[model samples]
Target: MQIDFSRSIVDIVLDHGNSIPDRTALIFDQGDGAQSSLTYAELATRITQLAGALSARGLAGRRIALLFSAGTDFALALLACLAAGGVAIPLAPVGRRKARLQNILNMLGDIRPDCILLDDSMAALFGDELSAALAVGPVRYLEFAALAAEPHPFAALTLRPDQLAVLQFTSGTTSNPKGVMISHGNIIANEAMIQVAFGHDQDSHFVGWVPHYHDQGLFGNILQPLFLGSTCVITSPAAFINRPMFWLQLITRYGAHTSGGPNFGYDLCVDFATRRGMPDDLDLSGWRVAFNGAERVRPGTLDRFAECFADAGFDRRAFLPCYGLAESTLVTIAVPPQSDPIVKSYDSRALAAGRAEESKDREGVLELACCGPAMAGAEARIVDPATGAALPDGAVGEIWLRGPHITAGYIDNPAATEASFGRLDEGAPFLRTGDLGFAAAEGFFIVSRLKDLIIVRGRNHAPSDVEQIWSELSGTVGQASAAAVEIEMGDTQHIVLIAEMKRDDARALSDEKVQEMAGRLRAMAMERLELAVTDLVLVSASTIPRTTSGKVQRKQAGRMLMDGELTVLAMAGPLAQAFGPSEQGASAAGQSALR
Candidate 1:
């Protein structure tokens, strides 16, 4: 397949529509044995029709908010927005939660989109809230059916390389979500990078369940396959979460060549297999590239998943650990296809002190997964965040990137854009990832987010390191999640370990058992991480807040803990004194503290 790098995605789609009209473009698994698909000709027609309608409404070059669930409609809406020469802002469908509705409203306000494309279901769900929010502005509400059903003749608009294509909102794990300005050039360059890195071709097939609102889903799952004019099978994140096996089932059903999600996804699959067992007909031999990214890639997750699915012909070498962000337009560093993931054990103590010293001994060592070298046409540098000087290999520092794939800046936020995207002393522009890591000859190793790092008594600890310890200890109880956050109390920063126990475990375990588990967590943190846990709180499952991409929102969790928003099943340590005696008391105390 010959790819013209000079053309925009819109042009490429049109070319594919003409050349491979009967080729399958997308297959959506409904997760209930029902499925639907579209050919290149059908996809192109829908996109063009919708685009013509949008253009007729004078929405060109305007921001259009796509508020639809992950499915064929959302995909069509997104492509139409881009085809119409409008900036597509894909947001998750609004839910019943007032807070969630407000967040969507807040985002809409920030971008001030000219129109919102949704479906009847979404309108019925949050019509009142949306109406009230948009009543204050001139934003138009356009339904997907109404737009796609209208017949309109349209010619594809030629797009410039630097023209803004999409406004990708950050997950807001560390701070308020900012819209990353992704240009047409960035998309084309990134798609090319992904093609070379993953060894994808026109014949390559994809099966993905990651939400389209996420950068990984939008770029890696949706656009990457389209760029190669290949078939892509997609399912909703909810479907995957409800049954992790469905994801593998789709890959097996379609003999998918590429598919992946965050590290937690791999863990979920391992858990599912352990509990329910894999189907006898399951076969993953054709899955050539299982790219893991959008969050910290865990070595243990890769190991467990490979071992669990080994019987189904899963290849460990196919595991590709990647590192990327929306700011970089999806992927920056990714392991080469068919290569064994690099896992090096570094001295935990040395890592805490800003160095990646290889540990010969197994004890007290952190196994870091190497998210391979910079993508083609990209350069990665490890620099001291405080000093702005490039650091030597094996020294932990901020990861900076420079490449055509890198986004221009945040939308309408000059302050943040200035802070994150800037030029180096030598006049080369780079995007500061705000992630702490060290680069070795093999590849780049991500340590932790700069904002989420827990500093205690002059020692730095990654929350993931501590959370991993808790996860291992709590596995016997049930499916548990942990959040290790740093909270400031009277001029001192303290580590608060919050564990979310599965509902069954929370109900079955006595207070004594919960306290024992908390004590074990503290001891493990001290022994393994050399850090003292100031307080430990045990809460019911789903207590820890997470971003849309399933990353633990440590900053938000920390704030929630301070504000007493988390429901405490049990508390350990001195902090318990603040929440006197009972669960009800803790809630009242938290409310009072806020006042």
Candidate 2:
């Protein structure tokens, strides 16, 4: 069942509708005991109907945002946009807060979509803000139900392979969001690469709860199944967040062959299993490929997940640690099926010097998991950030990639497009991933981002290192913590700790307790990292800013602190003295690097 890459995805799906019309294409769980199923023929017909309505409305070549809360509606609307020759923009449902709505407005200002597609329920949920937002821009709203009921004759799709198919908005970890311009050919090439990398076919069944608005969710779960002519069982992201067990239950019930999410998702499952335990009859023997992507893959998280579920016939070898970004259209590197994830140890000191030396002993070592080799038809290289020269294996540098799977550029942002897609000295085009990693004989080891690395006294420290130190005080500090830096006069930089207050600490707020916790944190920072903490700001849970993929927005956090937006529960150390270490504190600080 080889696919014709020249054909549009809509055409491929239509071919499936003709050859295997009765096959279950999509199974969506509503999370309320209600489920929806769509066969290929049924899906093709619905897509044709809605596409006809869109084409009648002259929406071809326009940008259309899909904002449905229901997975079924979302899938159909996305396909209809493609079939109608319009670029699809998958957006999260409108939130309630004014700030959230303002964020939506800001994105829309950049996108300037010609129309918005959503269901009636979402229309009601948006209330007056939807109308007001529409009034501000030249846009129209189309209800899915109404569009499906239209009787316009179906028109032939006019999309070309080079034409834009989607505007995938980045998670905004570095700055404001930018829409990655993904062409139809980019999707086709990546889908084929994923199939080759993951060993996916029509026999594979996928069960997932990652949000469809995300890159992993859109490319891995939803589109991969359709591209392979397979069945996809999907539930809302809220379902997994509320109860991660639901995801495992779906995999078990559906005999799903592939599934996965970020490292935090596995941590959540481990935490749930530890507290509530798993069902005695749960069976995960059919689960084959468990992909861990979209974030850092912690070595401990993999070990714990394996130990927790080994009793239920879950195989540790099924773990597949992978890495990619929206700029690459989803995945670039991935572990092959039926192989165990690669884990290695490196000297932390050498890593700061842009080298990856295998640690002789466990002491002062940093453990990293391999994200596998480059996918088929894709090539990756390590380049020195300062010199733009390619680095040899075992030398940490920026990850550069080149392949047909790479995206075109950002929409309406030539400066960003040029900056990210600059040419190498060898006269070859490569995408600068902005990630720090080193290639080894086994695979690539992803280190912290170049931007997220903190420089203290001319020493490099990953934010995770600082956050891990602060979160060890679990009783007083929450599990989530962010490490930020502020630069003052004389080119001096000082570390700032922003963390959530533990539930008990927030409930029993007192100046003495706050000061006590702050003092302990400062002491621990000095004792462990040997760095003087300038200030410790304790905030409520969910106050610290984070991207959609759960990565901390350190730059944004710094801005909030400077603007006095964060409610500070406690403050320690003199702000001005941060530039110059005090003699009293310097005398107390020891020589250690997070022992």
Candidate 3:
């Protein structure tokens, strides 16, 4: 009954029944504080029978897609696919992107899996042969539970360490997504490193509403628990977005020791308290690792969150600043859990000049939070993006990493792989994070986004520079009113602006005054920066899409502008044609979580 780390984890499940069988490996919460449990023994027996089922149907080594709701079934289906040596293409909730179930089918069709595993509800809607034909050609549908009932074929197969275990799709910078090829070795290494860095163990538990298909949720919330023999409670992100308190309640209910998300969750929770009467004295003392990452790590967001939850007994020390990308398998560096998050303030102009210059000027000073140091064996460096020369300490440059946990490259993107991961001036090869940050005397802090900048006419401009302008505006919380992205229209760079309206100003001022304010802001941007902002989107307060930590989802906002759904100023001429008034906020219909 020895657990084989090198073989299919399904094989390892065979050992679960012999030892620690009754221990709960997963806790499924339905977001309303209701819960269900699945022990290691129960999960192992089900997966074993499922592997037997898939083998009975000749599904071994065949590709299968899992379009599922977050539950024990979702986890079981994925493990079953792997136990039988079938490739699992998981599709989880991602906001608005998978609105139409047909789009889900199309993405799955691209993979052309032999069969699809779906929840009973999803099967009712998209599983009909007629809809399946219309959805994306003929892909057979199978209920998740059906697999567990199949007779035991019991032809156990072992996976080579290099064989593909999970073929996760990464939302690359490009419009089209690319599959991130993860081997058995990559998955195994990430879990082991995560177990050590994050202190995951059998006694530990994870509660997340993060999208399961994304690397962060899949690896951190789902697989990390599986590898460490702990309990993971996962729910759909849409559920939490609908009720932000659902996250806290889950932690309180499950006694979850660990939970984290992007900055948006913190903002949303605060906004909820202001708008609706949320429970005080919420009792989050059981929370151990309450870190936040995924995008910009905001100091104010953390402070505000700690202050908000202080009455609820949430410990401020549990808040940690961590950083990672899909390229590195979710985490590159994590500040020791509950460490005082470091914030490095810098000069705006000098930083825009491709030189990270530290400044103490209280006015207009930008604070970038520390993402801690590298994990055990991982190495990190800050290099000048232009010449690849290693930058001195205190200088902001592109973040590069080399580690056992890092993936080699995008599956088939040879050009990008070559451009991103390669030999650095420091002897060995490294993967460029395409992120702008400095290794502070304290450790890693991403100051600005490398590729998220814009060159208007001839001046190098950072979107954070514009975002900072919105920050100083009276009555605007840090990210309440700013997302700047340059849209390419012919040869020149056309700036697309998405800003949040101050509630007081929106309520008190006339529509004309609001328009005037927006116009003045645009004019100020042009005059100060010498850039023509083609469109201005004045959204209602608290509408901007930011990670749980405060990084703006500029690409998503840009997509909204490109679709003419973002309404800022009047749609006039080119601006009117591009920024149509769609008026869909964060929680819109047809929106599902990320895949």
Candidate 4:
């Protein structure tokens, strides 16, 4: 499993094609019992042919935007672009949604790719939109099918370690999207780290549904398998969202050894099983490493999932809570395979004060899942955000990382690059991840995003902690996705809770009943965290926006609430005045009674 840093991943593809041409390299599950697979020979041949075609077209060092859905086409396009010495910009296929399409168009305008690569089917589907994209700049469209039809003789291009391979765009949950420059060396180093940390080899199998545009899906689910010359089974994100059980079924069918996604994916599976009941024949014994990353790994989610599927031969030790971002090229910290996730209860007040204090008692405690130590050849440190002084263990601060896997910086944005990637006190270069966490003996425990921290009366309250507490208390709110944000009112900062209620619950509750529930939530917040909930706005389900990676966009939610963009089902407290005049009058009369 030793990775050769001297050779690029393109070279590995060629080697695999030559040595194990008959072995299956990739499989795409169509989610209806139908699947497609490609052998190593086919993959390498296609990549070489398409790469040759691209190079022959004078696109050796140009930016190519891949706009294919998650499938063999996307995988082939990405590898071929890299092989041809072109910068690959993998983007999710923009469907009919205007907002999503506009977002893609905006990104394209910023990147200004030389050519947009798509399959024949995709080009036909988005024919009109593709026409509109031409207005952004002088960009040509290249179909993979057309490129593959005419194969040209191609010689492997010499690649440098620092050569840019991918422009991974951040999910933009907290800010506008910026492309993270991932070098060839960064990918190789991170792949090696993942192979060692996750205990993967050629015999290992992977099945996942994370979108290939995301780093986790592209690197972990796809490239990592290629790195080990292993088979990887992939399905679209829609397939997994439509039926979470299909993800589990794929693992069962493939006897996959490594596969996972964000905490929400596990939560969905658990919820699906809870309502429909788990199938008795399903077995997950072969699942050795179920990594949870790209978002906070909730301990409750892990516990519920393990208990829910225990009868199906699912092992609790298979859970690997990890922490990473696109800037790291994929994984930075990951728990070893077959290790039980580390969970600890810390005093809520101490964590709020930027220090971790272990608490044995059940009252006023926050249970956090530990994202294990930095991967091999990587170093992680917690430093005070204000002074850049390194903090000792148990002190919550910004997590700084230094490793070969760490990407250089954001592309075309030197100010952002300078601000994010810097040396700590004249030491080695480190990526100042805007995440807040602390390192303990076990590993690192993420608290919240430094930007998402809700401050009220000068005390830092992690929005995740508040959201979790609200979720536990809000019974039958139906898919309790809550966003706790700080809204400034007349000379005072107020803690506002915007939550989603099921359609059934939203229609069944009377105005009086909604007020009562809001009052109870406010009372509970006061009793539990000693923080007053200034307002509670209940909206329909899926109202809150989330990044493609499933991280809640707290900042965007606050903006929507202030802009009156959200459709409110019910409201309580002073902020209710923003909803309408009737609510304003009602709130004015009943605000005192509720308080």
lDDT of 3 by residue, 481-560 (tens): 68878766544455766777654554566656656655665666554444456655566666566442234677767766
- Which pairs in model 2 have colliding backbones? none
Please provide, for model 1 over 283-341, each residue's C-alpha lDDT reduced to its tens digit, 9 standing for 90 to 100.
Answer: 99999999998888888888888998999999999999999999999998989999999
lDDT of candidate 2 over 1-595, digit per residue (tens):
2334688777878778988899999999855888999999998888888888898999977899887774777888898899888999988653456766676667777788999877777777664677776875598867788888888888676567788999998988878878999988888889989998999989799997888888988889998999889999999888897888888989998999999988878888888888898877779999999999887788878898999999888999999999999999999998888888788877777777778988867455677899999998888999988788999999989998988879988999999999889667565479999889999988788988788777765666666655666756653221235555543423445577777765566547665676676677767666544556666666556667877766678878766654445655555545423322211221111111101
lDDT for model 1 comes to 0.85
Which is superior by lDDT, 1 or 2? 1
lDDT for each of the candidates?
A: 0.85, 0.79, 0.69, 0.84
TM-score of each: 0.96, 0.90, 0.85, 0.95
What's each prediction's clash count?
0, 0, 20, 0
Residue-level error in angstroms, candidate 4, position 422 = 2.0
Comparing candidate 1 with candidate 4, which one achieves the higher lDDT? 1
Ranking by TM-score: 1, 4, 2, 3
Best by lDDT: 1
Using alpha carbons, what is the TM-score of model 2? 0.90
What's the lDDT of the predicted structure labeled candidate 2?
A: 0.79
